[model samples]
Target: MMVQIENKIILVTGGAGFIGSNLCEYLLSQRNKVICLDNFATGKTSNIQHLLSNPNFTLIVGDIRNLSDCHKAVSGVDYILHEAALGSVPRSINDPITSNDVNVSGFLNMLVAARDAKVKKFIYAASSSTYGDSEALPKVENTIGKPLSPYAITKYVNELYADIFFHTYGLNTIGLRYFNVFGRKQDPNGAYAAVIPKFVMQLMKYESPIINGDGNYSRDFTYIDNVIQMNVLAMLTENPEAMNTVYNTAFGDRTTLNNLMEYLKKHMSQYDEKIASVEVIHGPNRAGDIPHSLASIEKAKKLLNYNPEFSMKDGLKEAVDWYWNNLK
Candidate 1:
């Protein structure tokens, strides 16, 4: 996947958020002009504050719900990594309208802008929740089930719209259906914070972490680097088969909630031994929560030649170190 890195203007919507910020930083390191569009609703200034002074970095404070904002952001962008959306199943479950507005309507706005701008490609953040209610192990790209949550519905609609754009307007698009992603810069606060970061912060504080189910529920829990790699390949790939499709962006492994806590405790304990003594509590399985989730990344591996560099253990250890040093 080592093609000559081009000096193109790229727009990362939600570039002030966790994954988008990381992508922005990496793109900047490669000396590309990066335009970041965010409303700061979920995105934070702290994430992109480090890049404010960089010559190639620009942040447009705007919402994607406004087609004008999307048009303004995409004006000279060579590619669009459309990561702007309201994430979190619980959040979507609690307020489907807001999530629908941002994730659905906002996504359409970006697509129209990208198509009108004639961007080279549109790579977006799809979700593993698209596999909703399916009882299959190692979920594949084609075999999908009925969506269980409003969040899943929005992500699935993204794929459908992406397909239509390619067919109707010849806009190339790729959707990365991410699993339980975790790594540095991921927020550990807030009610809808991801499990790994939330647990790491709780353990660091010597507080209890609640497992939603009986601790048997598992997830692929992909690392940010793996996700970044998938995005890059999606953006630069020349294979026609790779276009107008979706791929599972994951580490291709699963860890139970209990096992995840053990790893977090073990890694964070290296910084503060008391974190190991922190108690873990269990609660009733959350509503709309699935028992297990795993992805078959063979499509990405074969099509995108995606070779994930980090395993879940490798990623967890690195994430713990970053949190320990940066958050504390």
Candidate 2:
């Protein structure tokens, strides 16, 4: 049995972020009352600005690191889609303490508040980085390697804490181990920007986009709509076995950086022919970077009936159109 996800109150943490904002928008469209809690550290106000006038939307400008904020956000919430955290492995490496504070400690704060509020479920954005140093091809839920970076460590810790919360406190939690997610509203301007949007923007300007490695590194590259679908499925699923477990939220396929560049250039050329001429530069491999990352999404499929609607190629085309129309 699946719980209907309409006309309920949902709290989306980091609601102004790329993934969070999209979740907020989707839940609102479903007639669910939405409370957006964000510190705007990495999240942008513009992302949720359009929803500000909606009667069902409420914005709480707060940090997850603050327990009071978490408590306040959960006061009347039915479910929580926790997307608040400092992303990017390099940023975490540069400031491990701050990352730990936000990703780990702040996560604890939200869990405590959710447990106290007795929300239906606590669904959070876990990461592919948790696979870490393992040379695994298709990462399964139970098997994992030692974390390779500070960011990886924090995300893995979140899974551990979520499991503990379920067992100890009777708090139902679902952790979605997201692969390389990308799509609309994904910011292209940032030192830590995701590769797809960043590359699209760079190519749009006829500037050469740099690949961090030999251009052979690959990722599952799940789309935002697919991610949103997984989140909704996580919320609606009444399967007892599905609750209190982690699932890989991905499209279950991988694309190399070189192939990704070709896809982007091919799509962008429709708007401007010059985009195709833009060269892609290959540089040395990035630190704490995995060579190839893929997901075995069988768990999510069998348990939640999660069917991803977008392939990497299909999503890239959609995302490129969005960036071209909005950013250009």
Q: lDDT per model, in order?
A: 0.92, 0.93
For model 1 the TM-score comes to 0.98
What 10-residue stretch in candidate 2 is worst by lDDT?
A: 1-10
TM-score of each: 0.98, 0.98
- Residues 162-200 of candidate 2 have per-residue lDDT tens digits of 999999999999999999999999999988999999998
- In the predicted model 1, the residue pairs found to clash are none
The superposed Cα distance between candidate 1 and the true structure at residue 125, in angstroms, equals 0.5
At residue 164, give the lDDT of candidate 2: 99
Which number leads on lDDT?
2
TM-score of 2: 0.98
Measured with C-alpha atoms, the lDDT of residue 324 in candidate 1 is: 85
